[model samples]
Target: ASSRDGYSWTEKQGLKSGVPCIGTIQPPTNLDRASTEVFDVIVVGAGYCGLTAARDLTTSGILVADNPGSRLGLRTLLIEARDRIGGRSWSSDIDGYSFELGGTWIFWGQANVWREILRYQMQDELVSSYDFSKGLNKYILVNTERAQHFTHEEEDEMMESGLRKLVNVDGEYGKRVIPFPHTAAFTAEALRYDKMSVADRLSEIKDSLTPNELSGVEAFVLLCSGGTLETTSFFEFLHWWALSDYSYQGCIDYLVKYKFRGGQSSFAIRFFREALASGNLSYAFNSPVAEIDDTKDFVTVSTRDGKQYRAKRVISAIPLQVMNNVVFNPPLPSGKRTAASIGHVNQCVKVHAEVRNKDLRSYTGIARPENGLFYAFGDGTTPAGNTHIVAFGGQNGHFDPEDNIGTTARKLQGLVPMDIERLVFHNWSKDEFAKGAWFFSQPGLLSNHLGDMRARHGKVIFGSSDWALGWRSFIDGAIEEGTRAALTARTDLAPSQLKGKL
Candidate 1:
């Protein structure tokens, strides 16, 4: 007999005593013989976006009862490709201390995500980073002969000048330096740095930078963009500045004030537990979807095992980079397919190391040509006294894991003098489920594809932090898109009006 947990079964002899035990009739072979089950909505992921959509859609006034004729208030199914929920946001114990593998750190002014944290009553554990008021020292090594340091004042001046050039291009300073998005005055201001590469823009102001200051800015750009200056768009830097009010001080302050004490993974745990308790959602783990076919009346989603699920509406919360892997009948719309094809940014390779000493002050170091590593930062106050330092290396695509660990360690040696006790790193590029850490806009692609990439298709909605209009690569954006997508779905269905007088 078939079982839900996939276990072999046999009937007890005593129950069929009247008939010969060997001749006991087998149970019905067809599992679907009872009735054709149908659901109102089928959310295709269990990430933050999928979970939020499922929760909001179910709790919104519509009710489900045993009676088949009872308006059939929105039945929802949440499926995850992984064996567990929480997608990219994960927290696990490492040496008895909580370590976050993906998506950590949230700032105070994030607005939407902050609201969700408060709504869930998870504010008590919030922690702040090292003091930002007293400017932090920045170090940079550009080849063997160019190692230098920048005072906080010099760094601030350089960044401020860059911002001024970006905003007042046609003013007394000349034409604007970048071509930012023009949706609103704010967006226009944000996009001013879009046209130029960071390296090219820096070259324009190289005369004003002291040797040490130039290296410092170069290092900062690399760390922020996860790539070298030549490849990172100048406009993206300006957009980041605009989001944080054009000041590194403001940006660092924002990051420090909105960190999670236990780590960002705590929020994921809470969300998943609450969703599971709702009793309205069902999940199929380790079940990768092979194909999706949508018709005028219903969408049929098939799994690898040939099992099929039918629903009236579907949401594709997966990232666009991996869209080609899943087959879609008649294919997704040309615009969406094109957006998915051309819109993916490069992947990231990040390394986290635990050192034996905590006395090492928190610092950020940039590597030069002679130096092996480009960036390293002391992660302050981890649960264990072991100093936690994070490094970002390699930007184009997946790197050799064995080669990466050694290369990363050599780079760290240039920054701090500590014995490396253990190391942990994740190459987001290698993960099949997530092809990259987060989506980033290439040079000219932002202007052309940003809008269409985020737009919802007929019955298949799209939502991910990568598509967020505000802080595109942040947790704040994830929550924002999740809520916005749910609202769009609810409004489309108009379930409240069909409740028949409640």
Candidate 2:
């Protein structure tokens, strides 16, 4: 691949942060004129969460009680920092292939995203990374010592045994620790588990597991947390286990098996289109919020460009780690401030590469966190018949994609030998808007700060994927929080409008 093909010798020289796409549509309403008017709702950060909230509010015919029996749509404004729609879930086109630069996979187990797939009639667009019936063609586990290949049966047996032992703290395979995975309900027993980090738990079971089994557990932890085991909460991992029906195979399927035919951008554009069709939704792209002031009367959101917008209610869909950048009028709740300051423990990198190796179409690679490459898998084949692979590595690791393209390719080859051609990626950790890849709660986040993170401050609602109850940090969670925040705003404002208080 050449520079003309969107591949450069260095990322700083040629890698585009986010590609141009149809999702960056201009809302029909003119923002210059709308600035003088107060909207019924202003949704900040036009990610999936904000998009869903704005869509619901603008579409629902909430009655203007002052005019009695007359239904009027709520005026909503969606402000985005980037020119595109999907927040961390973006799809970029490099040459003739589609590379999901951010969040990629989806499954039926993720209820909210699944509903949107059905609603948008995209069920036929679903595709698997590989045929599950045939299983993985190759399984290689890389450690400092060597790279060992295992048969499908051998890998499954070791993975199941190691993972089961890791989470079976109470001898019930995480069920007793997290009986209710979707809820914030934490028993005293659960709190005890919450206090332990992944590293701590691993140490508790390290003696009982074999070396290969231990490495399997380590690879999975590094993949999910994206951070080292010392900081990731054990309870957070347990919650995923319980949600996946307490089976290693189920977790694998739920996490990385299925993806949309085109990309997540297609799914996100559907929400954007629906919101615009409502006739009440207006939007401003390239608007980064600087400050949020809740003045008891209404909320005034000030962008960095010195423009102010007013709204009766505001839903802030900013990512958890990026929240510290914007100043709040009456400072955010103490717990929320603490959580934001501490941040999620997911500082990782995801890189997509095209390799001239058709034989690796069904290969899966996992390496120790200390290695340059932590995990990788064959996604599919490109138009040129090259294998498309997505690889992830932890921050501060040996691999630095931005440093040099040739070095990055060579490092990837160390994990899985392939004739590398081109690579595409986005450094989410360095992104001002994202600050991190995905949310992986730290040790004290759940037990000490979850309720406050979900609570609202005055008229500002916390509707981000970071604190979603069900599938936090996933596309499904973004939709769940977005839908809930919209309904909450409607429920509260309806009565006030009837009483003429708004």
Candidate 3:
């Protein structure tokens, strides 16, 4: 049943054996009692944040048998509901080609992720290994046509200035709105913007932009936020603007300009290796955490299979929307409860496709929501003369990856034009593990829920890129939150500081 590598599947032989070659996995079993019975810390969701938290939590202290230089090491267990790591940042395969079905790109602007890359020595630019968006042609859908016209100079100028004006309070950028962005809390200026949606703010600036400029900015921002401006809060974009130092160009650099040469999964694999090597970190795959009972002094985590694991400290790194489904014994704070009910607004669909064509120009085909395809661009050419392309959809249930990939290709072909071959995508919004894509808050979330939702409750600490102070909804933010949560858990579990500190 074993294939050439862990990823490939063999169908012919498995079919003869009357067993499936590929399918959904069953609940994990055979975990050592040391891992399942109890531990110092148990972190859920094994994604970027969970992995990072577990790594630091387990590695921070020295084992009693190992000279005991530092304090006693915290025994930790990290579990995931999915079969693989990298929660939203999954690097997968399609027809033997490396493809990123989710959270694809990263750049230097993302400090935390960049630090990980540097720590692992994964960056090598001498051979053109990293596909930095240095020379790709920019294209936009104009008037329902893949016209590839309309320059971003005017739009860029407008956006940079507008973003600065939006976040600037007390005549200074980020002074009032996002002073300490990594742990974003409500500020007077932040609350003012949090009350307004992107669409609402657009109304105030509509007269300042030309018609083409307006549409260009609108589509671009829509792609950025993953929903209509009406559903996305201005606070989200304002925070991003501040993260990018109030420059439109810096924001774009982190959003799409850079990518890992081997794929984001490579980073995840490397991260897991470090975490596992840190010691006493056990992980369970194909395990969905259903309930977290913090009723007693110790936290008991229950999986869908009814198995329970106890820990002194717990970090819930799952998606906000999915987190609502998990029953909490004492119940979550009103802020987390209210925010979980509302969830995030982002439902963007990202798809990767290959076409039997040559020299397909790399360009972004932009269109309004329903009139045409949202955006399309070529990733690179495969050895078989097929061009690897990636596309994004802002609306929900409109372009299902399984049922409507063909239609999506045709729509995009009409604008950018390409010979269709094959397509692959995972509907993240429909995915059980992650109910939606990245984080874009609805109106009032920043002012009403973010601060309280971020606070720790009893022995449980919540961490997600959804509310990260910087790089919200991104892998960078995930790392920031995970690293912070791990540190918080360590402090709370440490004997010297155990009186509910953190």
Candidate 4:
């Protein structure tokens, strides 16, 4: 049951497993034949990264002829540990309301994901989760002992002012450091301040900010750093600042404003469907890769059941923390191993709750990182007209949504003052395949290990949102890395096969 369902719900004392929109459905594949034949490229992890790579590699144009050797195009095999496709970016329907259990939200600024959205004609599916620019909604800020009401404008001002002080490391607001965030070409500038943590920077700017301003900044840090400010990198925050156009509003709008109306699962499934349509693609679900051995010419991927699949090139798209589970023959570099051991500092848990309050329907709740519930907002209303609120917190925080359901509900109510009905979430931190939620680089990570994290180990090409150049830790970043990995594999393939717009 755990293998089949990606989400769990807690209506009572313990969590009861529930199905995601796409995880339970298995796609048809010829894994037996796939194992017998050597593939041109093997993609591990059927998340957005692997799926995008498969799609691009398979559709790169093929030459057909009577002779088998005359045929062109990369034969791609995608292997997934779970029965589902999307790794952490999947959606579930709870009480007739769509809940994005993992990576959700996108914007026009995210080039790779936005391009795919346009290509798939899913632009119409995009919807704003909430528009803070309008100043129409109620915002609850709980930085002090009690919750206080503030208009969206007031909240924005405090946050904007506080962030200005926090991210302006070079007085140009990180521009001097990270002029091109996607390129990550700021090593020298970043190294100078690589040792500083988000907590350190916040402490430096706290005296300059008002109590409310400091509260807002702390909440932003908690949310952005995934509740680990003391270890989360200031350079990582600077990268985000540059990626978000160097504004607090841009960070909010780009990171959390927009999402697909049909849910991210539907969007992710489209890539799978398109990849499957290409005759060059095959896949195996429920096949967890135990080891990857890169010999002189080819790489052999061995699943837990001892089945081996050989490929000229392999794209390892799994998360950094999860990578420690898979053994490499020659072994990864010491830097990469150490980086994976440290991992990203995001042990934050995301929880979605349905509430029966009309007045609090579209409100945004912000709290101090230590307060347990760091950030939350009314995502949407259910068919029953109940408001659906999505909240995030640290794993060791006061709100234990996965356990102690009564206490979690009461704690949430203390923040938003709503009558809770149901709660749904996935514990990515505890999941074997994930081990953590979205990646937020730790101090000295970008300066010391970014290259090692993204570098290829012989024929095994590494691609993951965790190490993407631009939108790291986003669906867009997955596509960026996936597309790059596919193109890299294609370069090694026969030049005749690469005729399409890969």
Highest TM-score: which candidate? 2
Q: List residue ranges in candidate 4 displaced over 4 A.
A: 1-3, 10-14, 33-35, 62-72, 131-136, 395-400, 495-502
Preferred candidate (lDDT higher): 1 or 2: 2
lDDT of each: 0.59, 0.81, 0.69, 0.80
Q: Is candidate 1 or candidate 4 better by TM-score?
A: 4
Candidate 3 similarity to native, TM-score = 0.85
Instruction: For candidate 2, write residues 251-306 as lDDT tens digits.
Output: 88888888976888889989888888978888887789999999769899999999
Q: What local lDDT does model 2 show for residue 335?
A: 88
RMSD of 2: 3.2
RMSD of 1: 10.7
Query: For each candidate, C-alpha RMSD in Å?
Result: 10.7, 3.2, 5.3, 3.5
Q: Rank the candidates by TM-score, best first.
A: 2, 4, 3, 1
lDDT, candidate 4, 378-479, per-residue tens:
787679877778887874363446667777776677577778777878877778899888898778887888899999888899999999999999999999
Give residue 107's lDDT in candidate 2 (0 to 100).
94
Residue 72 error, candidate 3, Å: 6.4
Q: Score every model by TM-score.
A: 0.80, 0.93, 0.85, 0.92
Ten-residue region with minimum lDDT total, candidate 3: 15-24
Report residue 32 deviation for candidate 4 (angstroms).
3.5
Model number with the top lDDT: 2
Per-residue C-alpha lDDT of model 3 across residues 1-502, encoded as one tens digit per residue: 1111122112222111111112112333326755446777888987788878877787677322333335545778787887677788766544445666678778876799889889888877212212324344445555545364533454356556655544454577665676766555567777888888878878887776665556666766777777777888887777776776666677767676677656677777777777667666677877799999998878999999877999888899998878888998888878889888888888887766676654453455566545434656667666566777777776633555455444666666655666766565667777888877888888888778877768888889999888787787899989999988988876665554433332
Model 3 lDDT at residue 334: 82
